[model samples]
Target: MPNEMNKKQQEIKEKMQQQKYQSKVDNVTPTPPLLKNICWAFVVGGLICTLGQLFTDYFLGLDLPKKEASACATAVLVFLGAFFTGIGVYDDLGKRAGAGSIVPITGFANSIVAPAMEFKREGYVFGVGAKMFVIAGPVLVYGMVTAFIIGLIYWIRQ
Candidate 1:
């Protein structure tokens, strides 16, 4: 009768409210361990900058212009990155240090050249060099495209 129908409606409403409350409690996400390692990344990245500074100081001490010293530092870092990457030591370091190894110029070099090295192992001319730039190429193209669009907008506004 009417009393039975009212009881059923109350039961459904109570069940729905309980489910909503439970879902709200479950929605909170716990932090992952990987994110906790970000501190080590900052420390390693700072060390990399220190090395660049040392190189810049040395070049300046040799009477190089300020600009030249900076260029020299950049070149040295790039060379080290490429050389370490070629010997496969960079990846090993990355494994041990996690993001620590990834926040430097050397890391950037490794990012670009590691894929190329893999391809080269398959066959130097036939595989590697052809794809040496595969990973970096898209990034470069996209960066350029975005930069161009931004520049065009700026020019038009001015």
Candidate 2:
């Protein structure tokens, strides 16, 4: 009975020590400013979308059809994203804007180009070409597969 009692006391003491350590760690840890992060994300994401809209408008003004204008705008945004990423501007923006810079098509472009750029020093064929799709490859594959399945289902329903 004394042995069991001593064992229980040891267990309780260990738990108390763990709780004390956890409290100290929690006190030292800095909390993130959630509201500030959300605001930055919202503003940056909005600006990217607005830029896409402006590109679409400019293309439409040039007499392109609505579909073509939208496509051109997307292409422009992708090119801009890749260009900004290549020049290292996009990484800085991403740091400040967080997910704001990631939810847009520009983010998709960054995803593709960033990996390629990182591997470029290893040579074009083995490095850039191989790693270019490291981040975006799975996304593209799943997206295409999902689209094909959806189309097939729709056709069957019809």
Clash count for each candidate, listed in order shown: 0, 0
TM match of model 1 to true structure = 0.67
Residue pairs in candidate 2 whose N, alpha carbon or C atoms collide under 3 angstroms: none
The TM-score of predicted model 2 comes to 0.79
Scored by lDDT, model 1 comes in at 0.83
Best by TM-score: 2
Model 1 stretches with alpha carbons more than 4 Å out: 1-36, 153-158
Q: Report the lDDT of model 1 for residue 66.
A: 100
Error of 1 at 41 (Å): 0.2
lDDT of 2 at 124: 98
Q: Estimate each model's TM-score.
A: 0.67, 0.79
Worst 10 residues of 2 by lDDT: 31-40
Write the residue-wise lDDT of candidate 2 on 1-158 in tens digits: 99999999999999999999999999999987889989999999999999999999999999999999999999999999999999999999998899999989999999999999899999999999999999999989999999999999999999
lDDT of 1 by residue, 43-132 (tens): 777788899999999999999999999999989998898899999788887875676776677777787788877887779876776787
